[model samples]
Target chain A: MFNFNFSGEFVAFFVFAVMIISGAVLMVSFAKVVHMVVSLAAVFIGVAGMFVLLEAEFLAFVQVLIYAGAVSILMIFGIMMTKHQEADAEQAKPLHETLTAIGALALFGILFYAIRQSDFPEPEQALAQGTDNTMEIGKLLFTQYVIPFELVSVLLTVAFIGAIVLAKKEAE
Target chain B: MLSSYLTMAAILFCIGLYGALVKRNAVIILLSIELMLNAVNLNLVAFSKYGVVPSLTGQMFTLFSIAVAAAEAAVGIAILIALFRARGTVNADEYDEMRR
Candidate 1:
C-alpha cells in the first residue's frame, strides 16, 4: 500500500530479495533441523522468483521442480534418517565465528567493489525480446551444448549408483 | 541493474560460505553448499541477460549446473547418512577419524 514512484520490477525485486535473504538467514541461524530445511525451501522458492525476474521462466520452473521439490525432499529425508544427539547443536567457538565472519565480509567487500567498479556492457536489446526462450534453450541444449548435456546425464547416473551403494544396508 | 543482481549473488555466496565454514552440522554444511551453488546459478543467468552477446549459453550452463547440483545433493546426503550410520553423529567437528 506504500506505493510511490515504485515500478513493478522494483517491487518484485524487493519482495523476492527480502524473501531470499531472510530465508537464507533463517536457514543458517535456525536451531532446529526441520526449521532449517523449511527455510532452505523458502530460499529455493525465492531464487526461482529471481529467475522469473531475469526472464528465465524455464530455469525458474526447473529451480522449483528440482530444488524446491526434489532436492528439498531429499534433504528432509536425510534429516529424518539420521539421528541427532543433544550436543549436535553446540555452537562454534566465538573465535572461529569471528574469524569466519571477517573472512566472509572481506570476500563480500571485494566482490562488491569489483562489480561496482567494472563497466559491464548492457545488452543492445533486451535478452528476452518477447521470444520463447524455453524453445530456444531447448534447441541450443540439444545442439551445440549437447556434449555437456549428455555428460551431465552421465554424471547423474554415476551419482545415483554411488548413492545407492553408499546408503544401502550392509550385510551383517 | 546487472550490478544489483551481482551484489545479491555475492551476498548470498558470502552467507553460504560463512555457514559452510562455521556450522557444526554436516547437513547444514551441505545446505550451505547448495546456497552457494544457487548464487552461482543466479550470476550465470544475470550475465546471460546483461552480457553484450546475450546468447542462451548462460541459461544452458545454468541448466547443467542445476542438474549437477541436484545430483551432488543426492550423493552428498547419501554419504552423510552413511557417515551417521558408521559414527552415530552428524556434527562436522566430530567426524575426526582422519586426525587419529
Candidate 2:
C-alpha cells in the first residue's frame, strides 16, 4: 500500500493545480474583458509555477516574462481600445447568447471526454534522467536550432514593423 | 501528482476552447488563445520531465511555440485594431463581409 505522505513536492503541485484551474474558470466565466485578462495572467503565472515544478526554470521565467507580462497587457490594451456598443446597449440578450452558451458547453463536453480517454505515459522513475535541461537546451538551440532562432528574430522584427504600419493613423 | 497536473491542464484547455468559440469579443478570443497556449506549455513541460525521451525536445518545442505565439499575437492584435477602426466594432459576428 502506498503511504500518503504530504511531501513538499505534492503540496506545491496541489497549490499550482488549484491556481491554474481556478484561474481558467475565472477566465471563461467572467463577463468583463479586463477581469478575464487578469484571470489569464493568473493562469499564466500558475503555468510558470508548473514549469518550475517540472525543473524547467528558464522556461518558467520566459513564461512569466512573455505570457504574463507582454501578452496580458497587450490584451487589456486591445479591450480598452475596442468600443463595445452592443454590450453597452443590450444588458441582457436571451436568444443568441443562450445558443452560443449551449454550443460552447457541448464543445467543452466533447473535449473533456477526449482528454479523459487519452492514455498518457507514466513516469516510472522519480525524476528526469540526464543533465540539467537548461544547459542542453542552450547548446542545442545555438548549434542545431540556430537557423530557426535567427528566423524567429527576423519574424519578430517584421511583426513589429507590420504592427506599426497597421496602427498608423491616416491624415485627414 | 501527475494525474492532478494533467487534469488541471485538460481543464484549462477546455475552458480556453469554450471561451474562444463562444466569446464574441476579439480581445476575449485572444485571451482564450493565450489560455490554450499555456495549456500546451504545461503539457510540454510535464512530458519533458516524465517522458522516455532523454533529450529536452519538449522544452525546445515549447520555446518555439512561444515564439510563434508571440508573432501570432502581434499580428492578431494589429488586425483587431484595424478591424475596429474599419467597422467600429470588435464583435466577430460583425465581420460577415467575408461570408458573401
Candidate 3:
C-alpha cells in the first residue's frame, strides 16, 4: 500500500512530479517549435530537482548544467537553422498519430503492470555519501571508471568534430 | 516510493515515445529522444538510492549516459542542419528519399 507521508521529501516529490509531467505534456501539445523546446527545458529542470530529492547532488547539478543549459541552447540553435513552420502543416496524418499514441500507451501499460507486480526487496543500506560528493565522483571517475571515462572523452571529441564536419557547408 | 519513481519515468518515456514517433520536425524528434533518455536517467538515479543494493554505480552510469546524450544532441543538431541545407526543409516526412 502506498502511504502518503506528509514529509518534506514527499511534498517535494509530488511537486517535481507535477512539474515534470505537466511540462512534458505541454511539450507534446505545443504547436510552435520554440514553445516545445521551452517546455522540455522545464521538464529537464524538474528532473534535476528530482535528482536533488534523490540525494544525488552531483548528478542534479550535472543534469541542470547539461540538459537544462547546453541541450536547450543546442536545440534552439537547431530550431534556428531549420524552417519554422507550424507542426501539422502538411496534410494531417490522424491515423498515424493515433496509432503512435496507442502504441506508446500500450507500452506504458505494460511497464506499469510489471512495476506494480514486482516485489522489490527493501534496500539493505543507503548509499554511503561523503561530505564532498563531487570529490567522491571525481575519485571514482579517475580510479574505478578511468577507462570508460577516457573513452567517453574520446567519443565526445570525435562526435563533435564529426558534427562540425557534417554541418559545415560544402564548397560550391 | 520506488514504484512512484518508476511510474513517473514510465509516463515520461511514453510521452517521449509518442512525440518521437508522431512529430514531423526532425529537431523535435531529437528532443523527444532526449526526453526519453532523461526518463531513463531518472530511473537509474532513483534505483541508485532505493534499490536492494544501494551504490554509486547507478550514478556513475547516469554520468556516462548524460555525457553520451550531450554528444548525441550535438551530432543530431548537426545532421538536422545539414539535412535542412541539403533539402531546404526540416520535416521528417520529406526526408524519405529511400522510399522514392
Candidate 4:
C-alpha cells in the first residue's frame, strides 16, 4: 500500500493531495465564514490540478471556472447577503457533532477498505488519447451525448430562473 | 494509482459529509454539499482515466454533474437567502418550521 514510483505524475498527485486535504480540513475548522469559503476555493483549485494531472485538461479548466471561480464567488455573495457572525457562535451540540463525525468516519472507513480490497483489472484497450481533449469532448458532446447535453443546458436555464424567482423581493 | 485517487476522494467525501452535518451556517452547509459533489466528480474523472473500460463517458458524466452542481448551488443560495429574509438568521439549527 505504501509503494510509489518517482514519476512526475506521482509527485503532482501527491502535492495536490496534500493541498486538497489541508484546504478541506481548514474549511471545516475555520470559524470565520469568509475564511471557510476561501479555504474551499483552495480545495477546488487542488481538484482542478488533479484533473489536469489526469489528462482531463478541459475538465480542469471547467473546474477552475465553475467551482473555484464562480461557485466560490456565489458562496461569498451568499455570506455577504446574510447576517453572519464574525466568529460563528459555537453551539453546544457536542453529541450531535460527535455522532456526525463518527458516521462520516465510518463511511470513509468502508470506502477505503473496499478500495484497498478490490483489484481492478487492466484495460484491454487503451482509451483514445486525443491530441486535443477539448475538441474530442466537443465532438462527443455534439454526437453521442447530444441529447443529455441539451437537457443539462435546459436544466441550467430553468435553475437560474427559479433562483431569481425564489429570491425576488416581495412587494407587499 | 487508481486506489490512491479513490482513497483521496473518499477522504474528501467523508470530510464533506461531516461538514455538511455539523456546520451551523446554512451557507456553509451548502458549501459542504458542493464539496461532496466535487468528491464524486473526482472519483468519476479518476475512473475515466484508469478504469478497466477506459472511456470518455466518465468525463462526460462529470461535466453533466458539474453543471447540475452549479444549478444546485444557485438554487440553494436563493432558498437560503429567502429563508434568511423570513427568519433573519442563517443558522441551520434554527430552521425548524417543519418541526414546529
> Which candidate, 1 or 4, has the higher DockQ?
4
Can you tell me the CAPRI class of model 3?
high
What are the per-residue Cα lDDT tens digits for candidate 3 across A1-172?
Answer: 3557889999999999999999999999898899999999999999999999888999999999999999999999999878868554646789998999999999999999999899888898777878777888899999999999999999999999999999999999
Please compute DockQ, using alpha carbons, for every candidate against the native two-chain complex: 0.64, 0.55, 0.85, 0.85
Candidate 2 stretches with Cα past 4 Å from truth are: A1-5, A85-133
Q: Write the per-residue lDDT of candidate 1 for residues A30-49, one digit (tens) a residue.
A: 88888888998999999999
lDDT of 2 at A14: 79
Worst 10 residues of 2 chain B by lDDT: B1-10
lDDT: worst 10-residue window of model 3 chain B: B82-91
**Candidate 1: where are CA atoms >4 Å away?**
A1-5, A86-88, A128-130
Candidate 1's docking class is: medium
Positional deviation of residue A152's Cα in model 1 after best superposition, in angstroms: 1.4
Q: How well is candidate 4 docked (DockQ)?
A: 0.85
**What are the per-residue Cα lDDT tens digits for candidate 4 across A38-150?**
99999999999999988899999999999999999999999999998879999668999899999999999999889988888877787787789899899999999999999
lDDT by residue for model 1 over B1-100, one digit each (tens)? 7787888899999999998998887888998999999999999998898788786788888999999898999999989999999999888888987998
Which candidate comes out best when scored by lDDT? 4
Error in Å for residue A53 of model 2: 0.6
Q: After the best TM-score superposition of candidate 1, give how far the Cα of residue B27 lies from its true spot, in angstroms.
A: 0.7
- Candidate 4 lDDT over B1-100, as tens digits, reads 8889999999999999999999999999999999999999999999998899988889999999999999999999999999999999999988898999
TM-score of 3: 0.97
Which is the winner by TM-score between candidate 3 and candidate 4? Answer: 4
